[model samples]
Target: MSDPSRHPPTQAALGILFLILATAFFAVLDTSVKYVGAFVPVLMAVWFRYMFHAVVVTAVMLPLRGRSLLRTAHPRFQVLRGSLLLAVSAISFVALQYMPVGEFTAIVMITPLVVTLLAALFLRERVSALRWVLVTGGFAGALLVVQPGGNVIGWASLLPLVMVFTYAWFQILTSKMARTEDPMTMHFYTGWVGALLSSLVLPVVWKTIPDAGTFAILCLIGLMGTVGHFLLILAFKRTQASTLTPYLYGQIGFAMFCGWLVFGHVPGQLELIGIAMIVLCGATASWLTARDRRLPVEPPEA
Candidate 1:
């Protein structure tokens, strides 16, 4: 059989395609969360999201990888990682109730910038002047999206920012764990951990589906989250992350399109400018990270 990674050009192209498609699925996941959040309690929705994800991943991977799928060197870190992502999902569900899908997505895309900041502060990693500038510009862009006195102000606006920080830490931990852990094992543990943690509160938040349509949407949320991260893993396997990093910003565009299509929400001029800035700065930072060989090839939490 031909070696899949031998042809750089072909592998890169496939990686880009998979990354873009993964972003689309993430967009769908967010849009569905926003839609379903209105009818379902946020915690309940979160539980369903993680539960479905864990169940599906278990069903699919068990047969293929057997018990090896459950092995992990850092079991405690896996739980911590999963807990952080569960926090992210809960925060995202609440945030979406107040923020537009596109704008929320744009703000979350600042994660790479935040990661740079954290690495410098905690890891004592030296950062370049240009990267610092990009990081500053990226947050500035986020400020534009969640401008002061805007509709997304107050605690609601702060949610995604909180998510960025939480997710930044998650990314840092994942990068550390990826050095010694199987990606599939990490993926499996993350799902189950989130599911189990959220289930602790399920009894308080659980409610009837209200209708079949809502149940389907809940399932769609799980499928999108699972498939999106799975595709990200496939993309990284096929090609290097630096080559695929820039296209990750495509999630913002897909999200904006989904927002407009689903909610008829068009961003104002300033929001558009901010979104553009975030995309530019984030993509540039990722490129620089790749050039410096500092970018870790790991799938992000959905």
Candidate 2:
């Protein structure tokens, strides 16, 4: 197998392809999460997702790396990162129950902008004024999507916002820890930590899956999560993070298509406009951040 790490930094074309695949896989993963959410208890669905993630990772890694696969230099941060992602899954899954997948996906796309703004505030990074404008417009786009009184309201809409906030923090933690930890090691711990923590609530919330079909969907959810993330990692290895950032927006289009095909739903005029605004602003912010900071020569871990 060719080592992606040795690939030229300018593989923008291949990176876009890989990123598009990653987003498509993620869209499928979200669809499965939504499917399982319909029949499974939210907590139980999340637990199963992580539990199966841990299972898949362990099954693949233990033989190749032996017990070393379980070791981590930063166990605390690993656990925290895993816990944060579990929160994201739990909240986002609930949002999926009530919101259209495309709109929800578009709203969550604000994560990169939120990360940039948070970096400026917490990391004290000097964000150019243009990037700040982009970030502001991103939020404005999110507001248009939510449209407080238009239709989506109450707890349903807030869930994605919460997911966005937590996901931004998750990315910040990932960036910080990426400096010290192996990506595979971090991936391993993320699965196990989430599985272990979510297992605590399984006893109370666990319900027997009604049939083999639901069982398969639950398994598919876990499988897709792991695979989607794996593809994301591979894409990063092959090309610069900045080069792949724009392609990530492809998820919204995939989500929209999936929503229409599976659920027979389409966004309204305002919602479509909001999704466009969010995509444009978020992509601009991502490009500016990459242009300004010049991402590390080392490939970013997903």
> Quick one: best TM-score, which candidate?
1
lDDT of each: 0.86, 0.79
TM-score of 1: 0.95
TM-scores of all models? 0.95, 0.92
Name the lDDT value of residue 204 in candidate 2: 94
* Clashing pairs in model 1, backbone N/Cα/C closer than 3 A: none
Error of 2 at 97 (Å): 0.7
- Tens digits of per-residue lDDT, candidate 2, 173-226, equal 887887778777888898998899998989999888899999888887787788
lDDT of 1: 0.86
* Model 1 per-residue lDDT tens digits across residues 1-302: 23345757978788789988999999999999999988899888788888888998899999999989988888899999999999989998899889999999999988889989999999999988988999999999999999967776687888889998998898889888878999889889989999999999998888888999999998899889888988988887787667777888888889999999999999999999999999899888877776566756332334
